[model samples]
Every structure is written in structure tokens, then in C-alpha cells.
Target: MLFFFFYLFFFKLSAQTNLKGKIYFDNEPKSNVTVYLNNTTTGTITNKNGEFNLEVKNGVYQLIISHIGFQTIKYNFDTSTYTKPLVFSLLEEEFVLDEVIINGKENNDEWEYSFSVFFREFIGTSEFSKFCTIQNPDVLFFEFDSENNILTAEAIEPLHIKNEALGYDIFYDLKHFSIEKKFTKYLGYSYFKELKGNKNKQKKWRKNRLKAYNGSQVHFYKSIIKNSSKKEGFVINQFVRKKNNDRPSQEELSKARKELSKSNVALNFSRKIDKPKNSIDSALVILKKAKLPKYIDYLYKSEIASSDIIHKENNQTYLQFDNNLRITYLREKEEKGYILRNPFSKPRKAFLQASNIIPLAEKFIIYPKGILANPLDVLYEEYWSYEKFAHSLPLDYEPNNDD
Candidate 1:
């Protein structure tokens, strides 16, 4: 039995594609450097000679390599098309942390408030956020611009977070983070490592992970890829959103109201309307009804099939469409945080998670695991906008109900 197990392990290793690379810093071998494929568990540490061997499935991947005090290297390539070994030279990065230290302490009140804001916007406020702890928040630096009402943050080193809810340890190479006017924008590369636990604990984690997976973006993408979105309890509608030209602009309405307000205490009565209905009310009616909505959206009543938006070219899957896609996952109800943040109430029969997908380009490639080739090529609005890392699974997560 032991011999069979050994054979299986070697067989599996032999089947995987290997990425070989070496790292150097200041013309010297950089040992113990962390090298990994972004967002995946495939990773390795550099040997004393600064060499690494990473194994993964045959696909294109975003590679990351780094060590503290050294500038990180990120490379994207296709494993199936590349045959040459990778060589990287990392540069030194300076750290000036005194200002951040003094800012955290000297202004204790502001620091506390800033930290709270960062915590809510960065790590997020989902149910899983309570179980996710940043192991090294000290490496973070915060700056708030009072005039712009924006908060920006940077980190000297990778941020390590342990997620108890998902049974994973996550390392985020944070590139940028900002929050302004209740909107948050952050960009980063991440690597995930599975946490070890006993059988019972593992069972519970599997349940939790499966729960988080259902109705997620990846799930929706996967269903579309399989052409089973409707069967999987997802309804899609195509809509065109346009400006409501019938509604007057705010400036026009304001100017009209101002002109009426200046009307010498009673001259508004001359503004003819039948029965002399309260001068102010008559003027307001003439000023364009304030109840007119600012935008009008025409939604198609028919549900679209996955094939309408998903296409394959040159053996690669692509998602393309006109206007926007209104997706509703009926299997899962909307998150409580999503409901509280949005203006919509849960309709009696429409208790579902709703999101809108807008393409920033003509179309974007969809990789095998439901990951977008360029995440920024499209915009995710509504419920998707509210979801952060606390509610996410790594791109490489292979789902299984029995996990």
C-alpha cells in the first residue's frame, strides 16, 4: 500500500507542468524568496542558490516573486507556449516608517477612525470578515486627504491574513487602496494556502466554502460556460440604460425655482394655471416635475440563454454582449450587508442576489476557471461591488461538495 501511494504521488507530480526560475538581488543570489502563481496554491520558496521549481496545470498564469526589502516581480505568461527558464533581478526598496508611526500614535483619535474605515473598506464587513484577521497590519501606511475626502493606503511588505471562515492563509501584495465618498477601489495580487485542521473542522470548513461558492461570480461564470445557467437557478436579462431626457436637469430646475422665488410676494399668481392653484405649486408644476427619474432603463422581459453572451474562438472562451447583463441568482438570497447598503428592498418573490455586468471593452477572455483574463476590462456593479476579499475564494479553488 505504501508503495502504491508513493507511485501515485510521483505520477501526479510528473503530469504537472513545471515553472523553473531563479532570483537575484544586487547581483547576488536572493535566497528564501517566495515565488508563487498569483491567486493559486502553487508556490515554492527559493533554495539557497535562489532557484525555484513551481508545478502547475498547463495554462497561462500571473507569476509573483518577492522577499522583504526587495521590489517584487510580477510576470504573466502561458505555460503551454513557453519553454525558456525565467531569470529575474529584483531591486531594493526603501522604507520610511517614522511618519506612519507618529501619525498612528500622535493622532490617536484620527488613527482609530482611519483604521476603522480601512478595516471596513479593505478587509470588508461581510460575515466572514469577522473571522479574517490581518496578521501584519503594521506594515500598512495610511494617508487621508481632507480636501478630497479620500483615504489612500500602502504597505511596505505583503499583507498576511488568516481566514478562519475559509480555512486559508492569504498573502496579498497590495499595490493600491483608496476610499472616497463611500466607494472603495483596491488592486492587489494574492496567493492562497490551505489551512490544516482535523476531520470535523475540515468538514465544517467544506460546508462553509461551498456556501460561499454558490451564486458567486465564479459560479455564475461556470454555469454560463456549461450553458446551464438557467438550470442552475440563474436568470439573465439584457437591458439598455439611457438618460431620461424628459426629466429636466438639476441646474434648470434650480434656476426656475430661484426665478419663481424672486417673484415680488404675489406676482407668481400671474403664472396662469386654472383656478389659481397656490402660486408656489403652480410654479413648481411649470418647473418640470421633480418626481421624474434621472435615468430610464428598458429591460427585456425574456430571459437570455448563456450562449447569447458566451462565445468560443480559437479554442478559448469569450464573453461578449451588447449593453449590460442583469443577472439574478435565485438559489441564494442577497447578503444582509448588500440589502442594507442598497436602496432596494427584498421583493416578496424576488429575494435573490442581483448584479449588473458592464463590459469596458469590446469583450474579455474567460479562462478555464472562470477568471477573467483582464479583471479590469469589465465593471461589476450592485451586489458584486459590495463583495470584497472577505467574501471571495481564490481563482484556483476547485469546487467539490464533498471537499
Candidate 2:
């Protein structure tokens, strides 16, 4: 069951590498250790002798080594440079005795509320999400900060999630998860297993998988790397957005709000005090204005090619640009959810699958098959941010002729 049916996963691989490895704990062979490449179906569990083997195409991948009681190890490897018969020693997971979750008891009502928020933000709110289920949701612990209204969650182990829509069972090794009013952030590595189904179900899943992949970030990444954006029905536009000089920075606004609420919220910890009506009204005005956008976004009508913003230096392909990168996948129409959430006032704006990409760093090193060296180096918005586990497909997934 640990095997990924190598031939099936790497059927299209032009050049493949045979990878072999062993796991050890406290100087002894460790069995049943899970090893896999993140975001790909190239995975296998350790055998009785602690040995594992897998085949991968020539590419860079993050090799994940995980066990129930052992500390997880993420080893970055390249098929070209990494050789065979690799050995690893996993350390025991250290338990922190003092770290107790008190929020569940303090805010019992918020437990359901927090899980709802986590499910929406983490699993997503697309049509595919209805078919995704978290099998080990009970293992998740939560912490809610009443003052700041932030929700934090941690899982005792990898989350067992089944995506019936995609016919995949996913084990997600969650590292960080936190949600607040303005932002949500979670980081995890996932290993996928194919779910058996009837021919009809498999065919339907294939169609859905292709639909998810077509206008996705992965598809766009692949197109850019191959310099085939136009051929792939993608329109690239340079987005130049400027900060609103008329508005104060978020940090400044937050400080002002906190200072204004000092007599109101901070003083509540010790005793109850009445907030001055005029001061409270003034704070309300600033708080309402803070909810407005902070940037002035300029839409560019002149479209550009992927090659215009990407460069190759020393054989390493990277994306660098002055502002955000707006992408519109012309092959498919906008997901109904997006269209409903953001209705187009002008008929010209009724385009399919539009997303804005903002770079977190000055440059991002990209690879073939729509992967990035540091995936979090760029941020996504609009349609790109809408899809999650429910719409995910294995990197090796290929469409059948009908799909």
C-alpha cells in the first residue's frame, strides 16, 4: 500500500532516477517510516528492514521523512546530484510538558467557530471542498485569543484527509496554522495515495482533476517555465500598484487603535470602566476606515509575455518584475463562486480564472512542471487563492483522452 505504482506515476517522465534510502532510529533500523516527495505522488513506506526505494524524474524535490513518534525531517534533494542508498537517522519527537491548550476550555463556543474558520480557510470554499473530508479532525487543537481575535491550531499528527472529488487520500504534515481577521497562514507538506473507485468514478475524477489543473497556479507555472503561456491560453499583464500615501500604514493604524482602546479594553483586565462616548465614537470612525484597502491598484491593458518578466542567469530561471503579475487563463471560464463574489460591472472584464501574483521576495527561482524552489516566495490572490485540497491534483496527474 505504501508503493505509489511507480509506472503509473512516472509514466510520462523522460528521464528518471532510482532513489533508495534507509531509516534508522537510536542506531537501529526503523520500519514503517513514511517517505515521500512533497506535493507529488512519488512516495513509499519503509519496508520491514527500514529500506525504501522510489523512482523520480530529473527534478528538485523536498523529501519528507515522517513517523508517529519521531521528529520529521525535510531533506531537499535533486535527482541529478543525489545518489542512491541514502541513509537517515530520525530523532525522537520532543514533548513540551508545559505547553497546554487552555483555549478550548476558556472559549468552548469558539471551538466550533474556530474549526469552521479553519475549515473554510484551510480546505477552501470552492465547489470541490464539499467532497473533501478531514478524517483526523479530532487531533487538531485550537487556541483563540479573545483580545486580538486570532485563532491558532495545531495537529497532534499528520491530518488524514480524503478528497473524494479527486480520488486521493492525503496525509498532511501540518507545521503552522493561524487565522486572524485580515490574514490566514498555514504551512504543511502532503503525501497523496490514490483511492480505488469504479471506472465511472475514475473517469469523472479525471475530468474534475483536469478542470482543477487547467487554470491553476501549477499550470501557469509550467507554462511560464516552458515559455508557452500564450500557447496554454494564458494572458499575462504587468500590474503596477502603489501604496496609498493618503492613508496611514497598518502598523500605525493598529497602534492608534490599541492606544485609543487602552482605557476601554486593556483596563477591562482589572476592573470595568466606562468608555468616554466621544472617544469611543472617534475610535469607531478610525476602525471603520481601517477596513478599507491600503493600496491603489492600476490595471494594465497592455498584455505581456511570460518571457518578458522572466530571466535565465547561470542556467537558473527566475521571475523578477517591478510589480504584481496578473494572469488570466483563457481556456476556462471563471469559477462560479468567483464570478458571484466579484461580479463584473463591465462586459470586457468577464474573463476566466483571473489571479494576481505578488512577489514576497525580489526574485523567485522556478522549475519545470510548475514548481518553485521557494513556493512561498510569491503570494496569490483572487482565483489563485480560492482553490485548495479539494481541487488539488498530483503533480504527475495527466489527462486521459476523454478528459
Candidate 3:
């Protein structure tokens, strides 16, 4: 029998609406405030007068305004309703000691465990994470609520992260990070600055960047826009899971019990316990297989589906689907060859799932210029979810054309 190990693997802007804004703290103009659209590099620091302007296309964006001493603020801005320069008033943050002493000796273990968990989730588990280091881990404060089963983390200062894999120095202003039983979520603003490298290092970085881009969400979106998803090794299949209403009746159970009794009788009469034991094992296997389909109905099977790409006017593309979508990116021939030599190797095939059945609103959207922006836009449930900051690239990063 061939043992098949199924493994799950895992934006841009355009055009001409000016978003002018002023940031204030306690009714005083706050200069040097970093203002930017979340998940994109399009941003600017406030001038001496606390004024800044950004030109963006008509779309929905999460605007982040952050300063050193005050609390960071995020606002959802729609360009359609934006008319004039926006004014933001940020309040000062008050630091107070907790009376309950949550960080006592009893909770030290819990805190350490939570920190480890946070590091793994936030930095990721990929090879990239091996080279990524958090310079100011001491700035993070962790809390756990046993009643809610939530692990929360906050940072007093911007996290200094040095990524040797992608060659970037990142300053991340983490607002919140939480891990519940089923979900892990975090919200933060990051500023990525490229590291200076020699010619050979630059070449290596470009090669690595292209490797990261392939089989990524950005690559998938671009392939969809170009109507070349299949050509790009992407397989879109409809995932169907049906409710199994056919359960074993009482009569069936009684019959099964009677058969077992008969087998026992045969074993005693023949005075051969070993043969009957094998018979009983075979019978159990058959019975288990018979009832398996009913109890294990959640196992999804893929069905053939038509193309999901929909091209609209003005260069807009949509991946329209009703039920859940199972996307698979097949490995290249070279990658498969490498895997053949090493059976324990990680599979190059990448899988991701996007469902409309999520409890929250749909997070994915396709922009007019074929740029897909929004962290919440797609809930990557499989191997892609394992990709965190270590696998992340800047918004302005473009893969090398030669690749």
C-alpha cells in the first residue's frame, strides 16, 4: 500500500485621492507621527505642523496613526466619503500597576509558556524564522486569562526585528496579540527598511525573494488576474462535505453482536483460539470499514469545477465562488525529484482554503488594479497560516522578472 502523507503548505496602490490628515495629542499638534495604510508601504511621517497627505485610489483602507508616547489609533477610511483633511485627536496613555499582581510567582510558568507560544506563532515556524530574531523581547508583556483561554501580549516599544533571511530591518508597533483555543490573532503596524548588502548578497536575496513569492498569495492573485491559474500550477477545486444521515440501526447492532457470539462459540468448539482471534480481528476491521463512511463524514472530497476567474471592466478580476475553495499548488519537477531522494522531506505542494462559512465577515477582496490588500481579506486556514512575519515581504517588493 502506498502511504500518502497529505501535507498542508502554504498589494499595491494606485491613483489620485489625497488623504490629508493632522494628528494631535491633548489638543497639541503632534509632529513626526507615522501615518500609513495598514499592510502597505504607502505612508509618511507628519511634518512639523502635524500635517501629512497621501494620494490613494477609491477603496477601503485601514489608516494607522502612531506616535512614540501616545496610544496608536487605527481608523477605517473609505475614499468615497473622504472630502476634506481629517483631524485625529489621540489621548495620552496612562500606565498603572495592577492591584491583583497577575505576574506573581505562580503565574511565571504560564507567562513563559505564553511567550514561547507567541514567539512561535508571531515569528513563524518556517526556515525563515531560524534567521529572524526579536531584538527587544523584553519589551513584551504577556497576560493569560484562564477563564477565557486567551493569551494576550502587548509591547511598550516598537519591536526591533532583524531578518537575515530577507535582509530587512523591521520596526513593528504591536498593538495587540491574542491566542485563543481555536484562533490566533494580532494587529500591528510595521516599517520595513532594506539592509545594505554586497553584490553577491543582493543576488542571493533576489533569488530568495522569488522563491518566497512563488506559491504565495500574491502570486495566486496575479495568476488569477491573468487567467493563468492552472498554468501557474494552481488547482482550484470545490470542497464538498455532505451530511451523513445513514446511521447504523438497532437491528444492525444486534446482528453484529450475534455474529460475535457465534464466532466465540466456534472458537470454543474448535479448541483453536488463535484462528478465532484472527477471525474476530478481520470481522472488526470489516465492521469498522462498513461504518466508517457514516461517522467520518467531515472528510472533504474535491469535485471538478469550472474556472473561478471573472474579469470585469477596468481591469478588475474576481474569484467568484459559493462554497469552500481548496487551492493546491503543485510542486515543480525539480522539487519533486528532490523529494524522491529524501522521503522525509517537506512537500513542495502548497494547500490553502478559503471559505464563505466563516463566522466573521469575508476578509478577501480584489482591487481595481489587480492588487489584493487586506490581512483579514483571506483567512488562510492551512499551511499558509503558519507563515508569519518571517515569511512576510514588504508591499513594495517585486519579484525579479528573470525568475
Candidate 4:
């Protein structure tokens, strides 16, 4: 029996399967880099020859490659073809810092033109973009005219537009309509925000204030240890633990008020964490890195949409925009009806369901119509032509995965 068990165990272990790969820099093997498999605990580091071996069961994996100076590379794992050893080549990013700083600037620029004009312009733009900017268009009208045998209509884009020229229209004749004046005005507004000195100061003050409040509250709880009154001290201790559990205790509320009166992280962290023991020091490190949640940003359903114009169309010209001038409106409308589906809602959610899930990386997918599957299938068509024109990164993409 012992001999048979040993044979079975060895067979199972060998069948577990091992993946091997080498990391190269400039065609020479490198070492000490971290290789991560996405959403899974499996990862490894390269040896002297830039080689790594990973044990994986049968499944797909996204192999993430990251190192000190190279831009990260992620590749999809294909279990069907395990014969060739995996090799990764990372490109040196000449302007990584520039890219990071410019991301928000570029993001805001996307609507600088359209938002400047009629906010309802996204009717010809992106549906997702329209959803974000406005709750509804000012007008949504479609009419058929027997006199000219034509469809006539107009609707504003659903974002708060600063100027008029920024928005566009796709007419039946394949002519693209964009207003120049409104777009320049919107760009001017962006420039105005960038030049404001007080804006940066205000942001810094708020950050410091939040940090100060968190630290002071933690400190106020520790103050109970010094109070000698047994009953009161016990009560305070209970309050401290309760605050950490359900809500902020009385002592924490008091400290929170104190923190609101000041705006200095350096001073508050120092005073609140006076006499740094090991535990306090570690706590301070965590507080420094923690970020406030989106809920704290006052996210509530807006009574109105943020789009440029809020117009409604009363005629049938809208269909003409969809069918004939699809290419002209391509750059202006990238994400038409593609939303991050809520995964917890039983439809098998995508990462984009929550507003907080920003795209950290992306890959382009190519496919013909009607082949890809759910959520992925819906977004594939949107990305086909406007991949380069839009500034944001794609969160999920699957080609030929549609049913």
C-alpha cells in the first residue's frame, strides 16, 4: 500500500505542470525582476539568466512583467500551447513621468471641444460619455418630413459644455459639424484652472486636514491609558474600541473637531504620534499612505447631467447620424453604450461596474461583428475604430469571445 501511494503522489506532483521563462534586457538575460500573474497569487522572479519557472493548473493567466526601469508588460497565458518557452521584452518608456502628469490634462481635453458647445452633443458622441455628463438631453426628437422626404432633428450633448464650437454633428450628407468657438473657450477654462495658485494650496490643505483628523483621533484614544479613575478609564476604553468598530467614539469626535481647526499634517502627525514606539510608528506609516474613499467625495445622484448642452431631438435626423456618418463621428464618440457592468448583480460583473475601478492597463481586441461574448461583445465594436483618438485606456477587451 505504501509503495502504491508513493507512486500516485509522485505522478500527481509531476502532472501539476511547471512554466518556465527567461527575462531579457537588450537581448541579454537579467535578474531580480518580479513576474506577477494577474488576480492570482502565482508569481516568480528571474534568476541570473533571467529565467523563472511557475507551477500552474490548467487555466488562463495574465502574465504581468514589471521591473525597476521598464514599462510593465502583461501577456495572456494560453494553456493550449505550452511547448515554446515564454519570453518577454519590455520597452523603455522615454516619457513615463510625462504620461502620468498629462493623463488628467488629456482626459479633460477629450471634451474640451464638445462640452464647450451644446451639452447635448454626445447624442452623436459616446453614450457612456453622455451618461457621465448629463442625466438626460434637453431634447430628444425624431421627425419624418414628407415634404422633403427627409428626417430633421437636433439634440444637445449631455455634458456641461463651456463653449459652442467644441461640439459636433453628423449630418446625412456625411458632413461633420463642429463648432470652433465653444471648444477654444473650454480650453481657456482648462488653462484658467491650471494657472490658479490657490487651487493647489487648497488641495494640500484638505489633504493635511484629513490626515490630521485621523491621527488626532487615534491619539485621543491612547490618552485614556493615563487617566487613573477606574470607571471613567474603562468607559473611555470601551468608547475607543466601539469607535473603531461601529462609529467614532466621544473621544474621537472631540479630536476630529480639533483636527478641523488646523491644516498641517507634519504638525498633527507629530503631536498626535508623540514619542514614537514601534506600534505607533507603524500606525503612522499606514495613515500616511491611506486614501479617502469615493463615497467621501459626496457621490450622490445629480439632479442634472454634467454634459455641455441639454437639448432634446424631436425629429428623425438621429437615425441618419447613426447609419451614414458613423466614421465622421468616430473620434467624437468612442464609448457608445459601453458601461462597466455590476458583477455582483448576477450578470457576471465586469471590473468597470464601480466608478473607482480605473483602467491601469489595456489591450486592443480585433474581431468582426457578432462573435464576441457578453460585456466584452458590447464594448468590442465601440473600440474598433476610435482606439487611437480617445485618451482613456480600455478596461476590458475580448476578441472572438462573444457568442
Candidate 5:
């Protein structure tokens, strides 16, 4: 019996041979598809040119083929000594729901945070579509202030937008918002002090420079905005900075330095509207009704600042009763702040800010229009995913939901 077993082992070892093959889609080569012998836990991916080489034994086995957007396929084949080279034709699955139309062209393009409107300049585009759909009323608030010669602003409301898909809510308590052209110290480079350490190293670098002011920005938490399809509150803060590092001559810097030190520096606040809707219009009405700030440039240039919620407390206590015992719980939430310099404020001391807020709604509401309901159907379709089970597209891309 032991001799027979040894013979069988030798035969099996000699029978095993390498299986090589090329995978294609109808006559066209395909790449990145997984191919392997089924039920063996062994597989290999086709190279960039859709070529693959695998090893198999001299026996009948099942072949498996799979790709992200294609259906998995299986086929039975034998690895006999006389069998010729093998070839496979893979077919891609037609995901109709994943299809999108943008000006009659539907190509896969990853969504990014920046967008360009014509030749105006590249700017930060809203990531609302990236936020997961919320079934609750959540609001994100922000403010743009440029009253002082320093031209800094604060966020007076929440940083995360709750139920953002429904609408947006913002509260501004500032009056007379304006963007004024003034020379201000560039504090953004303050980090260099810690980074470089040596005081002389700091002096070797330009401490302050003049920038032709463009605009500013306040960071928004994309994650909070995503889960905020319901009852959510968040905040965003904005900041002002010189547009280009276009250094102002020493003389110009000296002249602006005097103006920067003024107390209660006389400045202007401008209210402008971009893509104004009923909600934004309503917010403007409130701003006007409150006699807050003067309206300056509409679709013009201005300086604005926004702050983020760095710390928060629920200020509430919850009690739970279990049989004869009671449990009370308290929690604390931590937030972070980010600073952004307006990339557009140069060669022109102009900027613009449009303010508005949308009211909350009940149930799963799609506001104004349901243009972005699919989440995957937005202008940038590459950043979204859909689950066969959920029947809804979410920004979350887990391996289980891939293709």
C-alpha cells in the first residue's frame, strides 16, 4: 500500500503542468480581469495587455473569470497532455443604472474637489454630491467677514450640513460685510518659524509679502456633509489672502503697513448672489430685513472668512431604564478647523460672496429638483457607487459593492 501511494504521488507531481492563456473581449484584449481554477483558491490577473499564464494539473477543472464591471463566468475544461493553448472571451456587464449623460457624452471621470467655469479660473467646487443622502434636516452654516483691515472672518454656525440634500441653512450675525483693498500681514507663513527653528533662518526668509488680493476659503468636512441626509448641523469658516505671491515692491509693503495697524478700520461689506434660488433669496431678504450689511458686488470680487466648529457639547442628558435600574449617558464631540487662502486674489483686489439658506423638510425629500438623487448621476460620476441591495447610490465604495 505504501509503494502504491508513493507511485500515485510521483504520477501526480509529473502530471501537473503550467496552463497559459490570453483573455479577450470578443477579439479585443482585456486587462485586470481575475482568472483562476475554480474552487482551488488560486488565481492571477491579466496584465495591461490582457495576457495571462497560469498553472494547472492534468485533470478536468473549472475556469473562473471576473472583472470589476463584468459578470463572473465559469467554464469546465480539461488539461490533458494533448490539449492545445486555451483562450477566453470575457463579456462586460451592461450596467444601465450606472450610465450617465453629460452633454451627450458619458465617459468615466473621477470626481474631484476643484472645478473650472470657462476661463475665469480654477476654483473649489462644492462637494455636496459626494455627501451621502440624508433623510433628516441638517444645516451647514458659514460667514464671510472683511470689516477689519486684516480681512478675516469666522464661522458662526455649524460646520456640517445636515440633510444637505434637502437644503442648506446658514445664520450670519455680522453687519456691513465688505471686501476692502488693504495691505495686511501674511500670517500664513507663521508655521515656518516652528518648521525652520533658528531665528536667523526665519529672518533669511521673507517675513511678509504683498499679494494682489483675490479671495479666501473656509474648509468643509466632507464626511459630516455626506452622512447629513438628516437632522445635521455644521459650520465652515473662511479666510482672506493675497492672490498671487506677486511680491509687492518694498515701498508698497511699507505704505500698506501703516493702514494695516488702524483701529476700527473703516471697511465695506458687500452682499452678492450666485445661482440664487428661493432659499438664497429668502436669506438675502432676511439679511436686508435685519438691516445687516450693505450689498456690495453681485458676481463681483470680495474677501471673506469662515471658521470651523472645533469643539461641541450636546448639553443634554439621556436616561435609559432597564427593569429596575436607570442609566444616564453623556458624550462629548471634538471638531477641527482648517484655514484656506483664496487662490484668486491677485492682479485684482476683487472678490465676491453669495449667501443663502434652505429650510428643512420632513421624510426623504429631494429639494428643488431630484437631479442628484442617484448620487452616481451627478456631473462627476466616477466618485459614486450603487448597491444592488440598497437600491440607492452612496459615495461609500466598499469592495462588496464594487462594480
Candidate 6:
């Protein structure tokens, strides 16, 4: 595994260029600032002069600069066009006092519940999440807005996360985290440093990483770029929601209810409906007959046949599609063994669905290096979106050569 990682690192560096930068705050050079590419392990720290240099591969990357007592900043740049030294000025964060106070007992209870929710959402719920620990949970502060049904969290300092499953200690400078009933979004900067492990432990991690990579979006993207999607056990199909036109009109519903009331036969074999006792009962019966099956059928038939649209321009490849896509990985399953496991593995539905279809705008172009320059180009729905930190791999990660 170490050899594989080394090979990848060297290969990437060979095709990379240098990005030098300095950090400043209030027109003064800031020392000891940590600078990194978001979602990748490539990073460096500012020296006494607040200057650092990084060798980055050809892709669009979010450059994150963070330090203690200052607001972290993320700047998106494409290596193809950004050939100048990057200068970042970070603002100092103002300290604010909490207006609301909670009693000791209440505070403890609320903190416990909120922390559990945040931990689950942040680290994820896979087997990896079980072993991942927040070494400094005390640095975290949580707030819940009951009226808006939103939960927010921030950190006083960088979160030290120990991922036993993947064998890495991640220094995560969490800028913001929020969770609502329908959606979860968080933005932060992270630096992943390898954890020392014995030979057996390293072997286990390698095996698990392979399992996680197999049917993942990263693998899918790479496969698509390589024109080997089918070879990689991925089956793609275009999906479209069925138009709902099965709703019964008021007159039809009224007629059906009257017929049901007059009939001697039962709605089901066990229970006979001689007559509805009230208008409410009559309406219930009518709705049960008119709505349930049609709704179910619509859901079942929502998917339509389609294929991924691939095109190339200026040596860069792009995927284009008009509707929702049903992505099926024949070899991937809801298993606990994969290191980079899917959070939505045990989905109720048979196939994974990616919806909220949108095209890749100029800002979201893909680089020839097989990285999504802008990951936020298309918003995923259902299972695809449920996949969070547990399924994430650094952009520099590559599957084992044997796999």
C-alpha cells in the first residue's frame, strides 16, 4: 500500500506545477498558517515569512488557507489559467457572546443530543464512522434553531479527527456545518496526515480501501473518462419521472363513493362496507380506491431509458445529460467491509438514483486529469447525495494497481 501511494504521489508530481503563496492578515505577514488544497492531501505550512509552495496537478482546486484566530478562506483556481503566485489575506474572527443561557441539566442534555446528531452527520454512519473519533470534541459548539428546524455547528479550533478505519489523522478546520430536515451542507478545510500502523493493520486498510473504491463516484468518473464504464461493472441508464395524471375529479370521486356505499360487497375480503357512517368515511374510501395504487405505479415507472452524453473539447472531456440517471454498479453491494463505504448502501430501492439534473456550466468544467473542477455543478438527490464523508477519498487517491 505504501508503495502504491508513493507511486501515485510521484506520478502526480511529475505532471504538476508549483504554486507559491504567502499569507497575510491586516497587512502583516502571518506565520504558521496552514495552506492546502481542499479535498486533497497536498498541503504545506507557511514558514516564518508566511510563505509556502505547493506542487499541484492539473485540475481545478480550492486552495484553503487557515490559521488560529483568523477566518479561513477558500479560493477556487484552475491550474490551466492560474499561473501567478497566490496571495491570501485572512480576516480576524470577532468573538461573540451567547445571548441565551441554559440551565446546567438542560444544557448537558441538549449538547449530548446535538453532538450525537452532528457527529453522525459529520463522520458518517458507516463502519468507518463507528471507529472515527473526534479527539477534541470540546472545541465544537452547537446551536439549534427549533423554529427553522436547522442545526448548526462551529469549532473554536481545528477538529482533530482520528479515523481508525482509514488510518489517518485529519486536522479539520471546520468553518461551518448545518443540517436541515431535507438537506445537509458543510464547508471546511482539512489536512490528512497518515497514521502509523503495523503491517497487518496496513494490509487491512488496503483491502478496505479497494472495497470502498469499487462502485464509488470517483471510480465511476474515472471509468467514464477512460471509456470503461461497463468494464468497471457500472450500468448507466437515463431516468425520468412519470407524469402523474391519475387523480380523480370531484364528480368521479363522488360517483365512486356512492357506488361503494350501495354495494353489498366488502372493500376487502375481511371487512364489509355496507355503508359509510359519515361523509368523512365515504371520502376516505374514495381516496383509498383512487389514489394509492396510482401513486405506487407512478413511482415504479418513473425511470426512463437514457445514456450518458460524453464529449470532448480542447482535450478536456465532459459528461452531458438531460434527465435523472439511474446508476447501477453490478459488483458493489451493501457491505460493511469496504473502507470507503457508501452511506446509502442499504437503500430501500433497488437502484441508485441521481436527480435534480443540471448541466455543467463553465465554472464546473472537468479537467483532463479526471477531476471535477467544480464538484457542485450538479446537485444529487436520494442515495447519491446521502453519501458524505465516509465515502469520500482525496482527489489524489488511486485504486490499488492489483484491483
Of 3 and 5, the candidate ahead on lDDT is 3
Candidate 1 global TM-score: 0.82
Error of model 4, residue 174, in angstroms: 38
RMSD of each: 8.1, 7.8, 8.3, 29.6, 25.9, 7.7
**Relative to the unseen true structure, what is the Cα RMSD of model 6?**
7.7
Instruction: Give per-residue lDDT, candidate 5, residue 101.
Output: 18
Q: In model 1, which runs have C-alpha deviations exceeding 4 angstroms?
A: 1-15, 82-84, 95-106, 181-183, 245-248, 253-293, 342-350, 401-403
Summarize candidate 5's per-residue lDDT along 1-403 as a digit string, tens digits.
Answer: 0000000000111266677777888788888877765323245889878887776556555566666456556666666643666678876666332222121122212111111110011001222223223222122111223254222221122122121221222111111111234211110000000123355533422221000000100011221223321122222222222223233444544444444345354422255655445443433433333332222212222221111111122631111111111101111121110012334324443222211211121111111111111111111100011000011111111222221
Instruction: Work out the TM-score per prediction.
Output: 0.82, 0.81, 0.67, 0.25, 0.21, 0.73
lDDT of the candidates, in the order given: 0.75, 0.75, 0.62, 0.32, 0.29, 0.64
Q: Which stretches of candidate 6 lie over 4 Å from their true place?
A: 1-14, 26-28, 78-86, 95-106, 243-277, 283-307, 313-316, 336-364, 368-371, 401-403
**Model 6: residue 8 alpha-carbon error in angstroms:** 22
TM-score of 5: 0.21
lDDT of 3 by residue, 294-314 (tens): 532242545323344443645
Candidate 3 Cα deviation (angstroms), residue 248: 13
Clashes of each: 0, 0, 2, 57, 40, 1
Candidate 6 residue lDDT tens string, 72-131? 787877777776888888898775636432331148877788889877667766666777
Error of 2 at 380 (Å): 0.9
For candidate 6, the per-residue lDDT at 290 reads 70
Clashes of 5: 40
TM-score comparison, 4 vs 5, better candidate: 4
Backbone-clash count (model 1): 0
The model with the greatest TM-score is 1
Higher-ranked by TM-score: 3 or 6 = 6
Task: Summarize candidate 2's per-residue lDDT along 107-171 as a digit string, tens digits.
Answer: 66766777887788788878889899999877777877779977778887899989988889999
Alpha carbon lDDT of residue 129, candidate 5? Answer: 29
lDDT for 12 in candidate 6 is 23
Q: Which wins on TM-score, candidate 5 or candidate 6?
A: 6
